[model samples]
Target: MTAETLSIPGLAKPASRIALGTWAIGGAMWGGADDANAARTIDKALDLGINVIDTAPVYGFGHSEEVVGRAVEGKRDKVILATKVGLNWQGGKIFRDSRPARIEQEIEDSLRRLRTEYIDLYQVHWPDVETPLEETARALENLVKAGKVRALGVSNFSPAQMDEFSKFAPLATIQPPYNLFEREIEQDVLPAAVRNKLVVLAYGPLCRGLLSGRMTADRKFEGDDLRNHDPKFQQPRFDQYLKAVEDLKGIAEKHGKSMLALAVRWVLDRGPTIALWGARKPEQISGVEEAFGWTLDEADMKAIDTILTRDIQNPVGPEFMAPPARNRVQGQ
Candidate 1:
C-alpha cells in the first residue's frame, strides 16, 4: 500500500500520511529505550516509506533527539526531522518557557543534539501564557529567516491562540492529540486548521495504546510508565475503554484487520491527517502496512461512533498531561 502524503511549504518532499513518533524511544514516561532498537525502528520506518520523524527536547531530556540523530546519520535528507521547543526542565520538574531568549538557546541545543543544521519542522510544544505570543512567534520566524527551520507548527493550541501566533509567523501545520476517543479538536481546532490550509498531524491515534486491542484487564504499567497516571488507564474508565476496545475489535475483524490497524486507519480516514505512530522497536511498527490501502466508510464511521458513545460514557481529554506555564517573579 502506498502511503499518502501532504504537501506543506518549505518541505522538499510531501510528508507521509503516517509519521514515526519518537516519544517512546525517548524513554521518559514510557520507560527507557534501547539505542540499538530505536535506531533499527527508524531505519525500518524509513525503509517502509515513512518519511517524517517527530521528537521533542523534553522527550527523554534530549535522549530521543540524540537517538534520532544517530539513526539518521548520512540519511538526514531522507526524512523530515521534526522537533519542538518551549518546555524546559528544571530540578527534575518540567515547565513551559517560550520566552524569546529560551527559544534562541533551545534551537542551538536541538540542532546539536539532532546533528542536523536545519530542522524540517520546528514547533512550539505547548503554549506559555507567561510569555507574550509575539515574542515566541518572532523567535520562530527568525529561525525561518535564518534558514534554520523549514516550517513552523504549534501543538495543543486553541484556535484563538493559533490566530495570535499566525499574526507573527506562518503556521504550516498544527499538532494535536486526536483519536476516536478524543474528538474535542473537531469542535474548533480542526475546523480552523482546515480553513487555514494547515496540515493536521494527529498524535496519540491509539489513545496511548488503549485502543490497541492487546490491553488486558490485568495489564500493569511500572517504573515511570505514563499509563500509571493516565485517566483512561485507571479503574472504571479503564474498564469502560477496554469494553469499547473489545467492541472495536469486532469491527476491525469485519474489515479483516486488527484493532491497532483499525485505530490508525480511522485517523487517516478523517482525511488530511498525518497520524503520528509512536514506537520503541521496529516490531511495534511492523504492522503499519495493515493500516493503509483501506479506509472506514460512513457506515464504519457511524458504527465506531456508536461504540464510543455507548461504551466510553466517561470519556475525557488529555488535559492532565499538560505542563504548567512559567511563573513570574514580583520584581523581575
Candidate 2:
C-alpha cells in the first residue's frame, strides 16, 4: 500500500505522511550505523512510498546528512528533504544557537553535507533563549529569499515562540515529538499549529522504539544509545511502560497490526500531518506500510489511555532529550 501524502504550501508536491527520520542513521548514537545499510534503508523507504526524509546537522555531527545525501543522490526530485539548523556542538558539547551568523554558516554546511542546492523544508532544531527570535527568523527568511530553502519550519518551539518567530518570517510547519506514549504536544502545540494553519510533523512516532513491541525487559543498550539516559528506560519506569505495551498488544492484535504500526497510526490520527519514523536499516522500517489506511476510533483511544493510566503510575515527558543552553553548560 502507498503511504498517504500531505501538501505543504511551498513544496512542489505533497509529502508522504510517514517521513524517514535519520537520527539513528547518524551512527553516533543508538549503537552505530553501517553506511550501506543506511542507504538501503532510504531506498527501502522510497520503495515503500515514503518520500519525505528528515535529518539534522547535529545528528552524528553531520554524518546522518552525508548518509542521506548519498542515499538520495540521483533521485533528489523524488524526495522532500527536511533538515534543521541551530543547536551547534563544540569540543564534544552541544548547545542551542540560532544567531543569524550561526544559521548562515550552518545552512551552508548542511547544504554541502546533504548535497542539495535547496532544502525543501528547513527548521530550527530547538528554540534558543539566548538569541533574539527575530534574528534567527530573519536569517532563515534570507535563505528562502536566496533560494536555498523552500519552506520554513520550527521544531520544539512553544506557541508563543512560534508567534514571535512568525512575526519575522513565514512559518509553514511545526515539528514536535508526538506518539502514543508521548502526547504532550496535544496540550498546546497542536492547537497552535491549527490556529496558525501550519502543518504538523510529529517526530518520535514510536517513542524511541518503546512502543515497537520489540523492546524486552532483558534488552540492553550499548554505545551512546540515548535510551540509556531516558527515564522511561530506567528499571521501574521501563517495567511500567513494558507492562502498558503488553496490554496494548491485545489492541494491536485486534486491529491485525504490529505494535509499531499501531503506534504510528495513533500519531497520524491525532492530527499530525506526518509521523517521522526513525530507522537506520532496511528491516527496521519493514512494517511502515501497515500504518496507512487505518486509524483509531474513540473507543480505541480511550482504551489505550486507560491502559497507560493503569500501568504507568509515574509517567514522564520527553524532557530529558532537551539539550542544555550554551550558558547553562556545566563549567562553562
Candidate 3:
C-alpha cells in the first residue's frame, strides 16, 4: 500500500512504506554523530522515497532535533515529522516531566529546535506517574487547540493508560516497542489502540539491530550505549539472540530479503499505522525502505513466530533496562 492509502491522524501515511527514525541519526552507538551526517541521512531517506520520520526531543537530548531541523530545512513538506515530549534526556540521563508548565514549555522548545511551527504528530514519550493523566491530556489537547501540534499521541503507554488518556483528547497514535523478541504490546496496547481506532506506531521493530543478523561480529558498545548494557546482548544470552537472528536470516532468504528487511516487514505486516525504523547508516535506511513492497505470508510468519521465541530474558523486565552483556535472569 502507498502512503496516500495509509490514513492516520495528522501525518501523511506513506503510500510506500518505511518511516525513518532519527534517533540514531544523532549517533547513539557509533559516535560519528554530527549535524552533517544527520542531515545527510535525512536527505538520503527522502531521496530514496521514504517520507515518514519519527523522533523525540530526548534523543541526543535535543541534538537529534537540531540535526533533523537542519536536514529538513528546505524540504519539510516532503516528509512527515513525528516527535515526542514528556521524558527529557539530558546530560546522559532520563527524567519524566509532564507538568502543565513543562509540557507547555517543551512544546515551544520542540517547535524552535525542529525549526518548524507545527509538529505533525506530537506524542508524550512516556506517562508521567506524578502528574494526573487528565492534566497531561488537557495540556496536549490545549497545544492542539493553540495550533502548536497538528495531532496528539503517546508512546510506551499501557492499554489502560491509553484508554484513560483518550478521554481527555482524541488520540491519533500510540507508539510502543514491538518486535519478534518483544510482544507485550500485542496483548493489551494493541487491542486498546485498535478499539479506539488509534494508530499503532511500532518502535524498535528491529530490536535495536539484533534482528539484523549482524551480531555475529560480536561488536562491542561504549559504556553509555543502551545495547552495550542490555541483557539480551550479553554473552550469556547473546548466543540465544544470535540464534534468533539466524532464524530471521533463514526466513528472509526464503523470500529473497535480508534479515533487516524481514524484520521491518514483519512489523509492517502487523495491522498498524507505521513502523519507526532507526537507521544510523545510509545502507540501513535503504534496506528498511525495501521491506514494504509486499506483506509476509502466513506460513512464513508462523515459522518466524515459533522460532523467535518470546524469551527476551531481560533482567530488568523490559528490553531497555537490562545491563549490557548480563544474563537475563541476572548474575547468571
In terms of lDDT, which candidate is strongest?
A: 2
Whole-model alpha-carbon lDDT for candidate 3:
0.75
Every candidate's CA RMSD: 1.6, 1.1, 5.1
The models' CA-based lDDT, in order, is 0.91, 0.92, 0.75
* Candidate 2, 150-260: lDDT as tens digits: 999999999999999999999999999888778888889999998888999998988999999999999999988999999999999999999999999889999999999
Prediction 1 TM-score vs. true: 0.97
Q: 2 or 3: which has the higher TM-score?
A: 2
Off by over 4 Å in 2: 330-332
Error of 2 at 255 (Å): 1.3
* lDDT (Cα, tens digit) per residue for candidate 1, span 88-185: 87776788899999999999999999999999999999999989999999999999999999999999999999999999999998999999899999
Q: Which numbered prediction scores highest in TM-score against the true structure?
A: 2
Instruction: For model 1, state the Cα shift of residue 109 in Å.
Output: 0.5
Candidate order by decreasing TM-score: 2, 1, 3
Q: Write down the worst ten-residue block by lDDT for model 2.
A: 323-332
Give TM per candidate: 0.97, 0.98, 0.89
Q: Please give the distance, in angstroms, between residue 185's alpha carbon in candidate 1 and its true position after superposition.
A: 0.4
Candidate 3 RMSD to the real structure: 5.1
Off by over 4 Å in 1: 328-332
